[model samples]
Structure formats: structure tokens, C-alpha cells
Target: MTLKYALPVIALVASAAVSAEEYQAFVGLNADHYRASGDSETNWKLDGTYFFDKKVTLGPLDQFEYINKVTNVSASFRREFDTNITRIGGEYFAENGLVVSAAHTRASGDYVNEVGLGYLVSNNFIVRVNAVKPEDESTDFMFSASYNHQLQGNDYVGFTAYADDEFDYFGISSKYFASLGEGRFIAAGITLDDNDGSSDWSAEADYYFSKMTSVGLTYNKADSYSLNAKHFFSQNWAVEARFASNTDDSTLKTYSLGVTGQF
Candidate 1:
């Protein structure tokens, strides 16, 4: 694929378990609000990975998020390059459903620096742990794990686990999917977050019309429904976008666009 559509490989889409070698990537554009600003106020990213002889993968990602809000130059709520982040890492496959991965991430604004580990379980489960630290302070750890079980045809059940003070403490989730003929899939999932630091329940869905075109939506208890879309022009090219209301009204809602391809 061209570099334009190669960015999605790193962005987080709802991922189902897959083989060790076969992988996925995507990228696109987005509009979070009908801003009067003259700028695209646009953001972009690139992400992708290749299985190491079908065993492990060297994964890397680069992302820039754009927030569009107009205010005084001194306004803290005004839009800025508030969250530019980049991550690069690798994953090692152990037997069974066990895979260990580590990544280093850097953030702009107030996001602390972090390094993390992820594990994928055979029971169709996923878990992640990250340690974030200030430039002058020690490490602070955060952890989360989630699993989904297929029941009957397209219905499934899942639960979320969290540790060390994140917005989401824990949640129970369920999802359903329907395959509408060839190359078309529609899916939806609902989850309720534990604790009350800000987040609540969330609902999301995606309708993939083809290998190259798709649309999606998400609603969080903290805000309104967000819009998501994607299009892949060819086997080697795809673009994707996500836009939503700021979960924290005190924070700014934003949009992210990404592109990707190999040399």
C-alpha cells in the first residue's frame, strides 16, 4: 500500500484474535466539529507490523491528534498540539495463548512518559499494563485486561479489569455481530465502566460494507455518539478516521487521521 493508507496498523480498532502472521492496517481523515477555523485542524498517524517468520512482530506507531477550539491565546482550553504521541516496540510469542510485548511511548502536553506490556490469551482474551512517569518522578503503573467469549452464533460476553487508578476501574461487556452476505459485517458492543472518576457505559458498532469501505459509531456515557469511517482503495492502501465529543468537557474533543504503507 502507499504511505497514505498505511497509518491504521497502529491505531486501536476493535480487534478479534487472529493468526500469528496475518495482520491488519488502516488510515483516514476526520472532522470532530463544524469548526469555523480555516485550518484542516487535521491530525494524522502511521502504524503497521510484520510477523517475524510468523512468530513475533516488530511493531511501531506514530500519531498526532488535532483539537479545534478557538479562544484567547492564553486560554488553557484552546486547541493546541495537546497530545502528540509516538510508540515503538516488539512482541514475543510464547506457546499457548501467551504473548509478551513491550513498548515505549512519549506524549506531549500532560500525558506522562510510559512503557508497557501486553498479553494475549488463548481464551480470546487481552490484557495490558503500562508504567507512566513524570520527567522528575518515579513510575506509576496502570493495568487493564479484557476477555470476550463467543456464545451461540454472533453473540459474545466479555469483562474488563483495571488497576492503579485509571478512568475505568472495570467493566462487563457484551457484543453482537451479523454477517450480511459476503464481505459485509455489522457489529455492536456495550460496556459499563466501574467507579465514578468520569467514565461510564459505552456502546459502539461498525458496518463494513466491503474490504475497502466501512462505517462505525460509538456512544459513551460521558458524552455524545462519535463517528468512525474507513476506506481501503486497494490491498495495499486504506484510510480511517474517528471523531468524538470530548469525554471530559473540561478537555477538548478531537479527531485523528492516519496513513500507512511499506517501503
Candidate 2:
């Protein structure tokens, strides 16, 4: 499957709306262009999410979202090579702090399944275990944990850790979000991943000029980086653009554009 970087952009847009009321539904359309080794390809993706409860919000730079009891359904579709890659998933967050999620994905005529169980240990901490199975592979188990604490108002710091049984992979990351007052905010994060005996590092930073506009940059140890920006025309609609290039290979690049809607 093609690597999809859209989720980070989506999260950035959602975080920019920290002071605004949360939306009950979201839809996004994105186009990606890739050029590598003198070959180029383009693909399109459509994705959406619907919240079952109106009270659930990405509160305080999205750090306190675990406190909200909500259920949500999400799905996405991508077209490449005249074939479709599709996924559908749903999550239920119970009032008692239990969380359940399941998803199914189909790509290249093969299916993959995933299920997870989680618990909100507290308003600021959560843990989860997941199992995944591919059409021709054994099931793999993964574990993850996250903790976030509010510093002040909309400012917060968070840490996360993850491990998977299949690849002997382990990773840890940390992020800090600062609300600069007057609709401005800045956030940064660093991640370190270890698979078998190999290691990789990545970092990202973002700045929100206002509740409706933001820009971000991301870098990987593998000599690749991306810059992206997003702006909302109104409370319910937005547009985004991104450019990425690999430092080791000047000819390898990617360009993307996206449109998003909230209601």
C-alpha cells in the first residue's frame, strides 16, 4: 500500500480549532502526486468521520479528548493502479472508560482485519492492545499507551509508546503544545523507532497563525521532509497544500492538495 500522510494534516487542522466548538462530522478529499526514480504516479483519496455524540471534542489542543464519551465511525477510499483500497472502522468509547474498535481494509484484492481494546486509566492517560491479521499472514499483537497533561489553558504535553510482536518493533514519542493566546499556537514532537536492530528518527513542528490557518514541517532521518499549509475559508470548509522531497534523491518528490469539510 502507498504511504498515506494525510492523517497528520487532518490532525493539524483539527488541533487548530481548539477554541471553537467541535464538529459532528468531517469529510476530506485529497490528491497526491509522487515522483521517484524518474517515474511518477498520482492518486486520489476520500475519507470521512461521523461522531455519535455532540459533546465529544478535541479539547485543549486535543490533549483531553479521552475524557469525552463518544462513538465514531470512519472510512476511507483510495484509487491507484485502477484498483481501490478501502477501509471502514468504528470506535466506541463507553462512559466507564472502556474503548473498543474494529476495522477492515481491502487492498489489492486482499483483506486485513484489526481489532483493539483500550481503557482510559484516567482523564489524561490511556492504554490499548490491538490484534491485526492479514489475508496470508498470522495475527500480530501490538500495544500502545499515551499520557497527556495540561500545562495551562490550551497548553499541554504528551508522551506515547508503542510495540508490536511481529517485527520486534518498539517506538516512543513526545509532543508539546503551547497556546500563544489570541488564536496562535505552536506544537512540536519527536519520535524514535527501533525495528529489530535498525533505528529511525522523525520530528515535526507546526504553527497556527489563527484558529483557521496553520503551517507545518516534518523531517525523517531517512533524508526526507515535507512542508504543508492549511487554511479555512469558513468555519465549515478548508483547503490544504503540501510539498515533500527527499534530500538523498533530488528527483524524488511529492505534491498534494486537499479539501476538507466539517459539520
Top candidate, metric lDDT = 2
- Residues 1-263 of candidate 1 have per-residue lDDT tens digits of 86666656433222322311222332222323433234335443444454343221111111100110111111011222446665555556554545455555556643345565666654467677777777667777778777666655333555666666545455566666554655465667787666656557889987777545778899877677678777755445556676665554523555656444422
Model 1 segments beyond 4 Å from truth?
A: 1-21, 24-40, 53-84, 96-98, 108-123, 126-129, 151-158, 165-168, 172-175, 195-199, 241-263
Steric clash pairs (candidate 2): none
Error at 25, model 2, angstroms: 0.5
RMSD of 2: 9.8
lDDT tens digits, residues 1-263, model 2? 32378777777667656555666788999999998888999999999988897643333222234234468999999997678999999999888999999999999889999999999888788899999999999999999999987786557788989999765899999988887876677889999999997999999998888767889999999989999998888777889999999888889999999999887
TM-score of each: 0.58, 0.86
Model 2, position 263, has a per-residue lDDT of 78
Q: In model 1, what is the error at residue 192, expressed in angstroms?
A: 2.5
CA shift at 71, candidate 2, in angstroms? 1.5
| Error at 138, model 2, angstroms | 0.9
